[model samples]
Target: MGIFPGFGGWINQNIQQPLKTSKRSKNGKSSSVSEEDRYIQGPWYWDPDISPKEKAESMEIDHVKSMPLSATDPRYYDLDELVRQNRLWNSEKKHPWNGAPAKVKVKTKKGLCHLNIDFTLGSPPQSVSEMFTNPRNLMYFHSMGKYKYNWRTRLDTRATKVLKKDGPRQITEVEKVLRWKILGYNGTIPIHLIIDENHQKVTATYKKVKVKHMKVFEGSWKIQPLYVDQERLCKSRSRISEEQYKKCSGGKGRIGSKVTMEHIFEPSSLLNVPPVSWFIRGIAVKVTKALLQDLREYVITYNKTETVDPLVYAKIKESIQKEKETELKELED
Candidate 1:
């Protein structure tokens, strides 16, 4: 009847932890704590430095220009491979996951782009529209374009009931309608949907729809482990009375180990989805220690240099030679 309520309660789902930035004490001592020992609560939203608009723009530009993530970096090739892998994961039909499309509108400092898609009318209620129109969603796509969408119902509920009786499949048909959003150059677009039964269509043109690439950091999720904190709880007392010594004998020597809590989850997983939500539901859970170890192997393979796998080194050398040849030929011309 209303928008879905916020999730509540503690979810003890096991997930992997992303790399965290933490500062050491002035003495420059390494934390004796293992990351796994930390516990954190969730509904963890992935926070990238740039706004979603910026991400969309970057992706659009990269795609439209057929450019790699980093043009100036040699590792761009490898990074491109990674990006391909990321997109492949999203587009796979077996996975009900969709990587956010980077929508961009390129103009001559003053142009527009239009997009058109049909909607099924009466399939969504007013509450769904309200959710789509939420401020957060609006701002997320504001730079891409303004939405001018409408839905026309093809059949009433009563008529649909009659149609279901006659059809062997007994499936009710939703109204077909077209939905569209329009945006100026460098505008953000909101991704909202409406239903229309009478399939109508609309068209939109933009100066550029290809923006920039989404910056996906190397993400890992794992179960947080218990940790012992060693910070001193209070100043050391001199000449403890026998009674006092007995009272705190077991708790001696600069903050004994204490339990730590941390939160970890899949990088691409949605924050709003409930814990234990299946990976097929677009929330990645169930990452295990073994998966992390395997991923580590891949990362290590990518990192090694002077002594790389012979085949890999040979391929790299061949690529280098070809690149050099191409450069020389261009220079001669």
Candidate 2:
């Protein structure tokens, strides 16, 4: 035999045989692979055409995509009827005056509360990222005076690091002190937040900053592009004629940013007075919804009045196009 077998048979046995092996035993039983092992074998060993760097990047993308968007995400929360039946909860009991988005959900467990909020801004991802990263814009949106939070006053604000580059991510951390008048209690609260930005996503996490009225106050904010599903695009195109689809730029969906915010905190005052939990939750819900709405409005207004630099806008647009293309390719494959 030539090298143990003919060329075609040897190739099949040596190259493709392992892939065809059932992930089961001869007893017709299924064998589960550990996540670590699967991760190693799935992308690293399977795709020989991809370079190591490309494989790493693809894994990173998959990881980012698989991250939990919120506590309410099905990946983390069970939607079974029994699970829902045992729960004691109320959602959207009090709507904010500015109107809350449908994606907002508030959940309370024991004495702790969580808010899962999702919204979309009118501007592209780059513009939204710029607005969030800029201190001036942040102050304008968050300062008590700007938002007219009569019950709260900003005492001082500081940033340890405005911006630092780590590999492909930009990191920033800020601290603020605010005086609050809640339930006839006057106290100072400190807030600390760290923001990390890569090319495709921005994540903001609140550190364990001490606050007089809060035992625990921490959360995360994530912003990424909202990708239209390929199947949806195909259906839309099928509905329209080819000429019409071409005129509409092949029915390419409008590019927008998807923002997800998760807030988990327990106010000392609220815990001290269990009856007022509902009141506190209402305030938190209102404030969170109002802030999201304000940000959305602000981005729309900013885009209308200000235009990003030609070169910067070009780069942002190109990055967005690349993301869209990648999403489409993944769907196709």
lDDT of each: 0.22, 0.44
Backbone N/Cα/C clashes per model = 57, 0
Among all candidates shown, the one with the greatest TM-score: 2
The segments of candidate 1 whose C-alpha lies over 4 angstroms from its true place after superposition are 1-291, 297-301, 304-307
For model 1, residues 176-271, the per-residue Cα lDDT tens digits are 111222232222211111211110111111111111111111111111111111122223445443234324534321111111112122222333
- The true-versus-predicted C-alpha distance at residue 271 of model 1, in Å, is 40
Off by more than 4 A, model 2: 1-102, 138-157, 162-164, 177-189, 196-199, 227-254, 269-272, 306-333
Clashing pairs in 2: none
Q: What tens-digit string does per-residue lDDT give for candidate 2 at 1-333?
A: 001112223233333223222233456575764322221121001111234564445444333213111111111112221121111111111211121343788888877888887877643444455445443213324433343654222333433332444333545455555544445554455666665545334556664546556676778777665432223444452444433533454434333467777888787854546567666666556655655655655544444443332223333444567789999999999
